[model samples]
Target: MSESAAPGALEQVRTFLNTWWVPNDTRAPEDRLPALLADPAAWQADLPAFAFPGREDAPGMAELRAALRAALGEARPVALGPWLARHPLRAELSADPDRPPLALVPEDGTAGGTILAAVAEAVRAGQWARLKACPDCSWVFYDHSRNGSRRWCVMNPGGSESRGCGSIAKVKAYRERRRITS
Candidate 1:
């Protein structure tokens, strides 16, 4: 998992968006959703909010994942209207006066609804724009920077230097510039 996860419920959206794994191996990168959906325990372990997903729900989950990837990665906007319409969340009043008055709940009690709800919440909090996808590796990461102008994933996550997409892309750009000048 990347250390650049968004704070609060937005972390769930970031986590779901980052499921498309690209390892540092020669083999082609792949989506981890299929394998994750096959195992119910894995679903609970990774996303407890998306609990008890069955094999039948795999297609929907995959579709949602793809739509989200496009929305995060591509220039064109992905119309999530149909999906959001299908999985609607109901507004509930909170018991605690200190807490926010309204809460959104999944009408269908599915993970998709929960994800959509989280997305809505993040948008409400104005943190949705901070979630970004790395151009080099297409990995989703949250920009926790104060200025909110962060465009790449960190080169070092846990203080040790690694070939994260940010450093790799900078190196490639540098090489290209040098090659042009030479």
Candidate 2:
């Protein structure tokens, strides 16, 4: 897949969580995520609110991300209990008033909340185990294969420079193999 294609919600949240280690300063590991999200005008429709909290006090974003990354890397199903309390969703009533309540939505409206919600949704759909990171680039992507064994981001050979990690790693492996063989 080309880099231009936007990721699905599950991948979007995973990518967002991966940015916890990065601060929006020099754009090294990644751009200033918090700052970008702060721009309401920039947020595309259908995405969760961009105003996620992270300042002097930590919002558990990093820890949550680390735990998720570790579990995904190990190809295991993560128990959602520890995070449920902190990122609780508000129960919503149905419009008809005669029907049951609608699905719960995040109370805080922060990106972290959105991401966590996505994880919960994925789990319920039996798709959480398919959300994974590219070992070469740490970029999160969904494994759409029948066996759910896909690795590497969906990008092809000419993927943008910002996403050259997979290509670079492939080249390195090729060279190492050639050296060992010769």
Candidate whose lDDT is highest: 1
In candidate 2, what are the lDDT values of residues 1-182, reduced to their tens digit? 53322234565665555553322233346533455456545434323433435452144655666667776634334555576677777766677765345545677765566667666656655777776777665666667778877777644554233555557677889999999999
* Best prediction by TM-score: 1
Q: Judged by lDDT against the true structure, how good is candidate 2? A: 0.58
The C-alpha stretches of model 2 lying farther than 4 A from their native spots are 1-8, 18-28, 37-58, 73-80, 89-104, 107-111, 159-168
Q: Give lDDT: candidate 2, residue 32.
A: 38
TM-score of each: 0.85, 0.62
Tens-place lDDT digits, model 1, residues 1-52: 3567788877877777777856555335778787778787876777776655
The global C-alpha lDDT for each of the candidates, from Candidate 1 onward, is 0.72, 0.58
Worst 10 residues of 1 by lDDT: 156-165
